[model samples]
Target: MPASGSVSVQSLDQFLAEVEGRAFQIARIATGCDQDALDIVQESMISLVTSYSDKCESNWKPLFYRILQNRITDFHRRKTLTGKIFAWIGLKKADEEDIDLLEQIADPNADMPELALSKDRFSDALIHALEQLPARQQQTFLLRIWEGLSVKETAEAMQCGEGSVKTHLSRATQTLRAHLEPHYFSGDHHES
Candidate 1:
């Protein structure tokens, strides 16, 4: 292989390695299941490597995120379809295990029980608010706020116009604020 080709491969590997953990977290939040999140991240990584490895390095972040979003959408669609089928078949489905939101927080030493409880409450409220958002709003908020994408980049990732991204973000923020305001500002961090 040419030296340039080798360099590109190395760069791609490093990029994937660095983003994999956060991508998994994003997928986990979107899917609400550990195994499904793992599958989505794996599939997104493979899709990016197979289809978009040749793109410019600067373009990789948005592209990878776009792919991840698509994978999450696909996962949700499959889940819904399967659920409908199961209902029609009169079959009982097993309950899904709960995923710990605080596990995603980067705290290697969680020695303080009070701090841990506070974080747990915040994480629960945040997750509930996020899950209540409309799909487009959730996508826009996650890409723009959580991932720190520009409006243009977020629009590109969601395959929408910049105005649409902004509108969705505005609605998402409003809804989140309404849902979380009481819990956030009431000074009730302790889980009673």
Candidate 2:
């Protein structure tokens, strides 16, 4: 409440708590690896706090997303590089299959478990469609539509021009529409 950049500790903490869940969702979608997504989200939060916490509350969304976007990009880069190096070395990286017992059998809170499993038909379809999109398109759609960032704010967060943001969103929308409309309008929404 002091100024844009210099928010009180409580305010900043509140902001992080509010955004963390959505950030994790976005990161999970982008990375397709839970542990990597967790690391990226945690690193992004730390980055926003260490580097830009003084920005106004209004500015925090774009700033935080900018950090998130960068972290995700770095992750993709590292993944690509690792894949290349392993291929060059003639070693196939084994998929991670060691599951923790707690993680496997833990009972999350009731609503959390239900909400995670029981997406409505449309919600499930939308998430499926979203997963098929390319990374930039997915990021653009999520930031602009899902996250409710304006064109300008999305541009700032994405480190791209507004025109680029518009192009990405338009392409993503078209793809999602093409992918979802048929399924949605079909007999998929009714209960037996």
Candidate 3:
């Protein structure tokens, strides 16, 4: 291979290694389907390699995320449009299910205490509650709180306005608090 081609390959490999997990997480949140998420991530990887391999390394993360986000949004749009058409035609099956929200919530196993502690239990409960939020809200909350990104950065990654990011994060926090409040106040014993 030519030197330029070899360098591009190395850059693509490095970019994929660095961002694969994050890319998958973002795609999962956006698509809400594991298979779809995987497909989108793979597609994004290929797209990045094909289109942006020659770009500066510093520009890779946002560009990769932006491409993945667009793919995810496209999937949502197609799903919505299909659902609408099927519903209009009265051909939509009641049993047809989309993504399961509960499974999408971040597990607190990595952060939770092994010993039974109220605060630990509360945190786990909160994490599960966060999973129950809408996809966009969960994304915003995680990007802001867990990822520790500034509002502008989160907005840029999410391809949305800063105001929208703030709104989503606000709603996500409120939803999580409301869902966790009962368990938090009840002093219930959480088994380790």
Best by lDDT: 1
Residues 1-192, candidate 1, lDDT per residue (tens digit)?
A: 646643367789999998888787778778778788889989999999998888788889999999999999998899899999999999968987775642455565588777777777877899888977878898899889988999999989899999999899999999999999899778877645
Q: Highest TM-score: which candidate?
A: 1
**Candidate 3 residues 87-173, lDDT tens each?**
999897564355543333444654665433665577568756765788789878866886566788778878899999999999998
- Tell me the TM-score of each prediction against the true structure: 0.86, 0.84, 0.69
| lDDT score, candidate 1, position 54 | 80
Error of model 2, residue 34, in angstroms: 1.7
- TM-score result, candidate 2: 0.84
Clash tally for model 1: 0
Q: Sorted on TM-score, highest at the top, how do the candidates line up?
A: 1, 2, 3
lDDT of 2 by residue, 62-146 (tens): 9999999999999999999999999999999988753221112233645564444434556768877988999999999989997
Tell me how many residue pairs clash in candidate 3.
1
User: In model 2, where is the ten-residue run with the lowest total lDDT?
Assistant: 98-107
